[model samples]
Target chain A: MNYPNGKKGSLTQPSQSRPSGAGNHAFSNRGMTLEEDINETNRFYLDTDKAIIHKKPTPVQIVKVNYPKRSAAVITEAYFKQASTTDYNGVYRSKHIDFEAKETKNKTLFPLANIHNHQVAHMRSVVEHGGICFLLIRFTLYQETYFLPAEKLFQHWDDKLKGGRKSISYDQICQEGHQIPFQYQARIDYLAIIDKLYF
Target chain B: MNYPNGKKGSLTQPSQSRPSGAGNHAFSNRGMTLEEDINETNRFYLDTDKAIIHKKPTPVQIVKVNYPKRSAAVITEAYFKQASTTDYNGVYRSKHIDFEAKETKNKTLFPLANIHNHQVAHMRSVVEHGGICFLLIRFTLYQETYFLPAEKLFQHWDDKLKGGRKSISYDQICQEGHQIPFQYQARIDYLAIIDKLYF
Candidate 1:
């Protein structure tokens, strides 16, 4: 919807409007989703023995499958399952790392609704367990990303419940979150922030 | 499909023959599969403040979707894209953690085929990055799971290509891989192994 700064596509628009069988065929993802960039970065880290990180498989509830003669089984029936944890996680230098990567067209504020209840709880556990926990928020329109700690997220979440704001203003994020730099090698360059914040 | 111990289920068995729609869906976990378990463990860690780990979402190439109503959109056409990294990843205690999980009915040996070519490359990258990387191997029949390091997996994989064994014997896994105990609190007691191995 209307991002705090009057930027980005409304969630209702992209998520709701769809052509028939639009999702069944594979789309090229010409523009990278946040997940892809992070995955590429993780690969670079792994290739150089720098870090190890991977995106977990989508949680799917398969209802049926089609077995075509001597071929990899095809999932004919399935539904998305609610995720129980953040999107990305791993270990670095013997320390636990956890985070969720999200993209928003909004140039100003990030919506809390984009963060799920279970995910919030999951991040809480990471912080409690002494792990580095945060969210990689991307302003797709601005092509900028910020790392927001779960604590700040919780604080804003409670604030939202009290009807203070619908989203985290860009100014608030810039004030509270660390801006992540982009590099050809690491792509997302998140570990740099981790080095500064957690290490 | 024949497991190492002599149990066999036709790999050719129709994927649809398994009618997994109903039953103990909570723990039943039909398609959520092994990755879901890892994600759940990550959530538990986030909630309890133990360790932080997560599996990335499936990189689906969604080409077609059907929207019968404004409120519902169903993916009608999609294809699996090749993944460049391992499935599960994150950080623990500031140290990067990365891995993949697989389940097999075979009792004798885990097939190298189960581990893909690209994934092997991904694991190698993690090793290069100075991060902890491994695989969670589950024997569904015996209900046994093992955490096998990528190094060992790589070695076996290479050996197989050179005309050695087609799989790693379970006995060998028991010797080289860390046995992941099943705990009521955290279904897969992987963090315990992390504590023992890295901490």
Candidate 2:
């Protein structure tokens, strides 16, 4: 099965040891999740000595911990904290790369509320400091991902603040953002787009 | 008082918070930890817009969450996850900067165990890719900090693999690493050293 993002899903007969592929599991259509695909691509990049990028783990504030014998120290009480920056950032070719990856099922427009105010401020700082910053938006319904630079995002964000549309239309994204290629191992292949725009 | 690199002894008092005639909490002389000082310095840099550097939040693997009515979701179970990279990373002058900070009470030698194998590997990758990478080591007893470059650290790490010394002597570090100056608001002025050395 070929997904809209160009991800190929493999079909195989059910192995008796594995649970029957049905119900909730059906949502995963064999093609990896966008985050999973990006992770794999990053791993491939790391292994081949190309670029160093990592998904910043979700931030959580731990309150209570239990040290059980013969087991690891387990955190019992915690709370998710709003992240001050984006989900992923690292260095590629001596340049700082900062970005947020968000997937939306809606196909018409990517909502501005999907991003946080502090994140916008951080991306602005990165750009002002001469680092490369952008947003990786995946339209799940369409299975297409686009890389929107921080400058363009700032413009749209400011426009929304000025009582404009709170979301950017799909057509505008198609015209302004760089479409990331979908490959097998390199999945998102965002760096390929970077090679064109940045290099 | 000052503690070891493992970050024990956090139970000192606020009585020492005020140093004599300093008009503030300057007993940082005996009480403030190196990490706290670095954090303050990073805050100062951010406020001044000199450079953008941040400590990545501690990674926690969330197991369960509770979404109560009309409030934020609360994480109920989680575990601290081993970080895959260095503690601090960001861009300085359009150059990628990555580093790990550790303080030791041991005045003569800084043990190799203070650093993890993966962290060393990650720093090596950063250096190989032309990004600036180093270890910020503080000798708590002497109130001294040194920036040990990744290249020098890799040499010592490789020597350990060859059955050499597992620790680098303070004298050796004093010769190889750049001594970072302590400042008032910019507590650990490592970037000042970067301005001198890299620039």
Candidate 3:
């Protein structure tokens, strides 16, 4: 029972009547995006009152605008911009949980460049402050998602300074990170890993 | 020197060569919004590595777009969207900080309606999870600001259900909340109050 891309967490009973294509298998919910799955899962969390998490909307810089008569303002110019913070953050079991989700079709290694500098510093700041922070990396080809703690990430991030590997091998992720279970309703059920580690 | 609205936290040499309109006296910054003051102060914090805070961009739902040849796509239609979370949130001194900034020209009372139901719920959730949550309220006419704790706000919010007053008097806020002093550079030096209370 999946609604369209925009109708998320509608503060009421999940409405069933939407577009025709409602189901996606594995990672295919009508060309379902990983972000879509996570958003839906977060909605599920909100519905059951399990936890409150939100994906910060993509930041856009609106430059020019026109006020059409008797209509909403039309953005004549705008550009998608870089986000300073991680995509997802919220509270679970009265503890702060923050993480970034990334996916790569490449099967062997997860490129370190996929993460931004400010985002890394942000994650570090969170963890140092006693908040739970991690990286949710998904391999699209393999359909596998791993939760890599910020501490482990910092170690690899620092290695680049010493002329180390530019990316983390998939094998390293499997060994150091926990696999995130994929549920039909909760596409990226990251809380499972959070519960095990934090609790 | 203030950069244009879009060029925020550009991580380089503070770029002092922007527009010159630095000092603001008692919340008077030559057509500057409260948001601008906080943003500048946050940049001061970021450049000196004092703290990391950001005003979450206003969420907008872009409905239509026009892509011309060899250039960025231009958003043609969009509507300002409601925020599911607060406008400002960040990590300071290793603790989670969340708040919503609001201003009212009314001198007598701060209306509860200004604070949304979901936002109030969000703040409560943050506090229940042991994070610091509060509201930064500005009395525009008086050029006075106060940091109203989420707990105190919740008391008033719930009172509405119990047939209590719909707004908090300016005097009540002054007594219950911490007055945020207006400064030259750090306009709303809220972190000062936070340091005294939380740290």
> Any runs in candidate 3 off by more than 4 Å, and if so which?
A1-31, B1-31
Q: What's the residue-level lDDT of A95 in candidate 2?
A: 83
How well is each residue in A1-199 modelled by candidate 2, as lDDT tens digits? 3334554222332210112233335445554556876898899889888899998888887788999999988887787888998888888887888889887766589999999998998899888887899998877655677999889999999999899999988899989998876666577788887888898
B1-199, model 3: which lDDT tens digit per residue? 4434433221131331112233324324343456776898888887666766778878889988888899887787777777878988766775667889988867799999998898998888778766688999877655567898889999999998699999999999999999876565676778998998887
Which of candidates 1 and 3 reaches a greater TM-score? 3
Residue-level lDDT of model 2, residues B1-199, one tens digit each, is: 3323322221243422323233444555565667787898888888998888888999887888899999888887788888889999887888888999998877599999999999998998898777888899887656677988888999999999899999999999999999876556676778877887787
DockQ of each: 0.27, 0.64, 0.40
Query: Where does candidate 1 stray beyond 4 Å?
Result: A1-49, A55-58, A70-74, A91-94, A140-143, A181-188, B1-59, B81-84, B87-97, B101-107, B127-131, B138-147, B161-163, B178-191
Clashes of 2: 0
Question: Interface RMSDs of all predictions?
Answer: 3.7, 1.1, 2.3
Q: Count clashing residue pairs per candidate.
A: 72, 0, 4
Question: Candidate 1, DockQ to 2 decimals?
Answer: 0.27
TM-score of chain B as predicted in candidate 1: 0.78
Each candidate structure's TM-score, on Cα atoms with residue i matched to residue i, is: 0.67, 0.87, 0.81
Q: Write the per-residue lDDT of candidate 3 for residues A105-143, one digit (tens) a residue.
A: 666999999999989988877786667899988776555
Candidate 2 residue A155 C-alpha distance from true site, Å: 0.8
